[model samples]
Target: MSKSFNAYILESRDKPLIIMAELIRKALIVRFQDKRDKMKNYVGRICPNIQKKIEGLKELSNQCIPKWAFDNLFEVKCHGEKNIVNLVAYTCTCRKWDLTGIPCKHAISAIFFKHEVVKDYVSHWYTEDTYMRAYKYIIYPIYAG
Candidate 1:
């Protein structure tokens, strides 16, 4: 599950930006470092089969968004047979994102709707490592010196 999907669940409960961002951060860190914010190894496993599917969709060279789905930023229809619902910006209608901080199948499907996004990176959830790595070593704590 990607971090953005997780964020969408927050959408259902009316999650504040701060809370949504926090969950995204955790997911990313785990993906990049194979560890969590507290430096602990992940205890669970995401489906490798799903990972491969996400990869295949990303590799497409054309704007191959399936015809059955919508293109707006939010609420795209399912590809075909999949009952999953996709919420483009906030969450997928399938409610997986709402139930848990994870990108459901629909969210991934929406991402494919806009093939420009790199699927491998998109599907990989966010984590604190990316956040800290991006902004760390910036102005130190005021009390430090």
Candidate 2:
């Protein structure tokens, strides 16, 4: 990452600081606009990368056995390890869901047991709308002569 930034700096090293800054700003605007346009027609509920991760976890969830404990609570056993899942809170004893904003295998099993849509439980931050919102603002170009 540092090397990439260094290359950008090297390209504008002969110019004054103000000119260098403007060049970098213009480069960033172009990059951001490209990204925004690229995702403009996306229709997925969640971002593709995050959905892929969730699909992988869904397969793993089949190995887990979920037992209903109480309202919105479940005990899941997987590979001889026990975990607690709370649907309302969107948490698991393993803490993976709490930290990553993505449900862990245990939570997946619990959600499956309840016949709930796995994608619905995912954090809004991983949604396609949120991803688009992140690149929504444009950086207008300036004549940096």
Best by TM-score: 2
- Runs in model 1 lying further than 4 Å from the true structure: 1-88, 116-126, 130-145
Tens-digit lDDT string for candidate 2 (43-100): 6898878999999999999999999999999999999999999999999999999998
State the lDDT at 42 in candidate 1: 31
Error at 8, model 1, angstroms = 32
Which pairs of residues have clashing backbones in candidate 1? 9-97, 9-98, 25-127, 27-126, 28-126, 28-127, 29-127, 87-92
Task: Candidate 2: list runs displaced more than 4 Å.
Answer: 1-16
User: How many clashes would you count in candidate 1?
Assistant: 8
Which 10 successive residues of model 2 have the least lDDT summed? 135-144
Per-residue alpha-carbon lDDT of model 1 for 28-65, expressed as tens digits?
44454542333343322333444455455445312323
Show how many residue pairs clash in every candidate, following the order shown. Answer: 8, 0
Candidate no. 2 TM-score:
0.84
